[model samples]
Target: MTIPRSSCLLLAGALAFSACNTGTEQQSSTAAADSLHHIVHRYYDDKMQLFPIDATFNGEHQYDGLLHIDISEGFRQRLDSFAGRYLQQLQGVDTSGLSSNDRISYEMLLRELNMTRESLQFHDHLMPIHQFWGLTLTLPQLGSGTSAQPFKTKEDYEKFMQRMKTFAEWADTAIANMRKGMATGYVLPEALVVKVIPQLRDLASNDTGNVFFGPLKTLPAGTDTAFASAYRHTITAYVFPAYAKLQRFLQEEYLPKARSSSGIAGVPDGKAYYNYLIRYWTTTNKTPDEIFDTGQKEVARIRGEMEQIKNSTGFKGDLAAFFQFVRSDPQFRIFKTPAQVLDSFRAIEHKIMPGVKQMYALLPKTSFEVRQTEAFRAASASAEYMQGSADGSRPGVFYVPILDAKKFSYVGMESLFLHEAIPGHHFQISLQQENDSLPRFRRFSWIGAYGEGYALYCEGLGRELGLYTNPYMYFGRLSDEIHRAIRLVVDVGMHAKGWSREQALQYMLENEPLSEDEAVAEIERYMAVPAQALSYKTGELKILELRRRYEQLQGGQFSLKDFHDELLKDGCVPLSVLEEKMKRRFE
Candidate 1:
């Protein structure tokens, strides 16, 4: 569920032209290449200014203290003008004379510019502060001094204060936007609104234990008591009050006006907006019905695998009964402490080490770690990987939400580790960042179909990783796949086909071995962010298809390590683009 932060702007790196195979003169080709490079570099620079937070997360700290609140009409007009200017400039270049890699870059940038412009047509800013991806959720993580925002120097502390003030202003803008949305029937789902209120209340608690005081608690080897005292006073006097203002607004002004319906289809222009989201998430032309049907087929296939595992365990019951048994079995919930749960994941890492070496020829030099999710947000957060600092100051982290050790199920741990830790996000993201050849944008870019799809594909490597030997553990892997497949069906169904929140929740309960709370959380996630859940299965199927085609064609010449190496070398791209790249190289 975690991805590297990406800019909404076209943040592509400049690419050079390779030797031309076209019948153009070398001088003309060279001129075209130079012009395109200048255009791309300029676009990259402008995007960094436009999305300072994304730049800061990607290790560029030039705009450290600045925060951009883009909900205003003036900001929207400027952004639209910016996107239009870039698109016009990009189209002016003669792409026919460019190299293959340069062509890919040009196409990718063009797609991004067009998509960004199209997205502005929808009023996403109105319902912006969702439980999953809103500023309300992310600001605390940054302020905690544990995230990408650094706190190593006195100036770093000052920058944080300025950013906090900017955040307060952003909060005011958010309130205004929500009011605007209310007038236009663009409010958030009431269920999600209720989830967000607690988060705001926690941040706005105005206590010493609040995460804003985190940096002051562990000063970076400094002897600056006076400065530290000032920082604390600032947080209490200014920052905490901002959160309190937001909390009051949410509880008193926003919640009652929130939408009663669960789907985006309830809002004005919501149907078209959802269609845009589908295209944005999947990076494809496939319709909602197509994705829903694909989910159905994948669910059936995984169910058959789960049934086989059930019979192997000698369970004398139907699939639903077996699912219930796995869901509540005390034997599977043996962990007594959070440490034990984390240790089990470490054991999974050790068990899979050998197979990982065999599969991936080029491993990331960046260090990796498995950690417990922060206690404040753990309840609602899914187990996810956070990208490390490119300089290796921060290790790539896999954070598991061990809400209650006794409630933790061992069924999905092995596959979960494979997907979120080694050979999945860690490998894909670290390798991308470490490669200096990639443009800064590509190094940190995310195409969910490529990124999440690759992670889901990693789950199938359980047998290769030497885990999933136990029948129940194997079922756990199948269960994880079914979880994604169910998302495909229910995400589109709820948004586009009139399926209610309860219908989606019931579908999950009938098919997967999830607790009612877990089911509710997953359903609400889909409601908050539409079409994103489809990426896992869609991307995985495409990659698997390509792997099969290459394996059959290459026969004895094929190498798994080489396939993985090439697959990840280019970082993330649209599935159609990835398939074409793989075909030209492998086929």
Candidate 2:
């Protein structure tokens, strides 16, 4: 989930409707349309300035020299003020005559603005970064000169150095915010804080071998030999010292004072914050109790299927025993080298290609490759897809954290690929980014429920793609589904139901074939970002519901390929908007 980019490239636009208007209609609509268009463009330009790192990641080079520090009170006020003004201006746009797509864009913009405004009520900035993800975690990757931040030119290197200096400032601000959070009873869990200390310690060291020196090792075939020494000195003088300062703050100032409690519910107004996050991530009105019950039902249903698979394998013991067998079985861990692991994924891709070609009518022209996760963060990383640059200069990458090839299991490779690689994030993101027909905002925009949900839904498509033929692979698919199902329970359980970290970890160890380390890492991830794990299931279930309804209503007339194409045609949108669109098109 520590993927390079974050949420959608978004705003409103009316250009999508231009082609359908008659001369008189065009003349009447043009002025209003032009005003709406100008407003959207201006909003995007402003956002690019406010969150320059995000802009850099979104393929806007102009902001690469800067970094936005939202941890500051001033920055928060600026963001909230911007959101309010944009919301008002956008509401003034007349949507009655806009095209359906443009109307959807308008609705999407309103949803985002409203969400942004509502979120400003909380003290989320109090806890700016965590071990799992955020600016702190991503800075190393960007500093390595391998991610979205370009390091091809001297100016690029200079911009990155400036960004590093800003990062040091941001780190200081984060410490200040953490202090504020402590005073306001908004501190992170002790377990999460413990994890954070080590990461900071790792980052702050005067280790020239750090990721910040990655560019110096192998210059990007440019005439930058002289600058490497200066950059190295900067890392030592500025980056390392800044990190050391942050590490000292974490170890000496913050950790002892961090709360021993596990859930955010223990904090001030924590219950309200959790509920708000539920809506924020899922984009739904459902209560946490509703999602909890849904999770219980899904866990039970998936367990039954897993049981059936266990019996089919003629395994003698109960589900727990089978889980242990899968966890410990040497047969599953046949991968000899990292290359073999990558090759295994390639094989799965090849095996499913024909079916993939037939299943979806539209495909991304953006190329994809499978690689190992970067060394710096691989220990805590998950298998995830990094979206390519929209301009097609970089290929989307599926990074698998193969810490030890000898222990790598192929059991989950098929399902993992289906979720993170071809036909999952790569497919969904690339097509969205590649589709020039969509407004620039929508093209890069992603709603977790819509985007991640679609990827989770893709996990089920393995059966149709001639995968999961091996009983172990089938179990892997079940295991993956149960993983998401478990998330729904534990994410809601911890933050809302007072479930302890130990209880959540035990629940996962009992249900899934995860090592204790893996289970612990996952539980902490949910703790760090509450209600996020719920999005995978919440979004996937909606997509699956739409698919089922379309299949039943259209019956023999339903075109699966066309259905898929349409589902992804508009890129990522809120589930509600997608449902409305589907009903209008099919019903």
Over all chains combined, what TM-score does candidate 1 have? Answer: 0.94
lDDT of 2 by residue, 1-587 (tens): 44333332221123334444455576656655666777777877888899887787778899898987877889989989999999989877877677777777778878888888888888878888688888877888888877888988778888888888888788889888888987888888889888887777787776666888887766556555578777777777777877788788878877888887788898888899899888888989889889989988999999999999999999999999999999999999998899999999999999999999999988899888999998778888888898888898888999999899999999999999999998999999999999887767777677898888999999999999999999999999999999999998888889899999999999888888999999999999999998889899999999999999999999999988988988998989998999998888889
* lDDT assessment of candidate 1: 0.86
Per-candidate local distance difference test: 0.86, 0.86
Candidate 1 lDDT by residue in tens digits, 161-214:
888888878888888998999888999989998998888788878777888889
In model 1, state the lDDT of residue 295.
Answer: 90
Alpha-carbon TM-score of each model against the true structure:
0.94, 0.94
What residue pairs are clashing in model 1?
none
How many residue pairs collide in each prediction? 0, 4
